[model samples]
Target: MEMKNNTVEVNHIRKAYGNRAVVNDLSFVVKPGEIFGLIGPNGAGKTTTIRMMMDIIKPDSGEVKILGETLTEGAKNNIGYLPEERGLYKKLSVIDSIIYFASLKGVDAKTAGKRAEELLKRVDMIGHRQKKIEELSRGMGQIIQVIVTIIHSPQLIILDEPTASLDPVNAQLLKEIMLDLRKQGKTVIMSTHRMNEIEEMCDRILMINKGRLVLYGDIPSIKAKYRNNSVLIEFQGELGEIPGVTEKRPHDHAVELMLDNKTTPQMVLETLVHKRINVNRFELSTPSLNEIFIKVAGDERE
Candidate 1:
């Protein structure tokens, strides 16, 4: 409820094009030193919302506050933003492009140049520093973009699908960089459809569907709300209806037993042991963020 201490406070923002409302009455807050996730299905108005937050586009109604104040020309310098769309000066060398972007954010050439070398090395792209942007691969370009985004050492960082062009190794490196930024007390906002990344990196998440808020909360609380009501087991015996399980979903190598509230996973394991079933693996199954995403967004379609 209090907005002053928050890094970002978005209140009742709405945006529409002609007849269709792309973002409708969306509101959320990002706390200082936390990684907040903004997620939704494609065409769910995430980009529209980010654009409004950056003041690249105006919302039909509502307010967006960055670092507790409305975005100003001077305030822009303290924030690092990477939009979904990627762009760079094709003719310029990698180091040149990084310095150019930093200069735009008011970082002097001396400091920017020093920071550029450090960041390029950090991302393992120092060897490509002299290459023109047009000559680099997609993953290489993404690394450069990331370096450019944070070269100025902004207080707040906003990235939309920052790992979209990266390989697994590069993506992992970026994750480390982001985690390091958080440790430095910089606030981060990441917008992506990668549910695994959301669960692993974000402290809180806001999910929108068809331009409307569907789910919003901390990761633990949200998963606890959809608490594990099933158990997965790998066994060799014929799985006749167990006493506590209501339904059995079969797999080629395993079976998931849906449990009633009255039965615990311990009870099911005991039942299997008593029946002489050779249990290789058994554990309570919690709903993954990806499953929850599909459920919430899929329900919107039906």
Candidate 2:
């Protein structure tokens, strides 16, 4: 058996439709046993890149290596892929539908059926195993889709917006399952626009926009690189007044202060003390993934 290390590698990949490029010169790697986040805005070439990786669509240029080898039928069978735009057979019962999809992934029918039932139970959908797909709620069907995606227990699972159309309870369950998969030494490639999920689950991330790589690295390092020169303060009564603060946004007795180029956090504290301001909390923190994501991916401000 090959020792676990780099699970996926995409080198200078590019894909196009007619004259329009979808994924332009994109490149990234997914390490084993980690949730690697692939995030971008709508029409940002996320799906295009994923398809190339799966060999569902060939990249116009570049190569994708899985488990240190070229993609093949064996590679595809060992990978679980849940597309963003997905559907289950409406006329088929839940268990049968799950079993069918898992079988397509090369799992034996008996094993697929058994694993499907267990997964449905885990997601609190065991009672509806016999129900037709159309009979279940949208959230329930989405859960089933996820179950099918992982029923084969593949080494690499790629989820494209897996939490879409799911309720909070099921969403939390899916998040827990993703984390558990990581713990079991399974590599997951998650593509989503949700910053909270990325922050909570991904060990590293690659952010792309307009079919080009924008940001790539571990979350903490990216946060540090994009740290806004600001302080988040929580104090009682009133903020009163403080110097060196270029701008401020207040919220529920707390304020986010944007400091001037020459203003230090220490100066702000000293000023507060000299002014006799009641201080409850003083902290300087890195910018959130949401903020940085918007900065790189655009917030539709243009």
Question: The CA-based lDDT of model 2 is what?
Answer: 0.88
Worst 10 residues of 2 by lDDT: 293-302
Expressed as tens digits, the lDDT of each residue in 4-103 for candidate 2 is: 6589999999998999999999888899889999998899999999999999999999999988887998778889889999999999999889888888
Per-residue lDDT tens digits of candidate 1, residues 1-302?
23349999999999989999999999999999999999999999999999898999999999999998999988889999999997899999998999999999999999999999998888778899899999998888888888888999999999999988789998999999999999999999999989999999999999999999998989989987876689999988777768978998986788889899999998999999999999999977778999889988888999
TM-score of each: 0.90, 0.89
Stretches > 4 Å off in candidate 2: 235-245, 248-251, 270-277, 299-302
Candidate 1's C-alpha runs over 4 A off are 1-4, 234-244, 261-280
Clashing pairs in 2: none
Top of the candidates by lDDT: 1
| Model 2 residue 215 lDDT score | 92
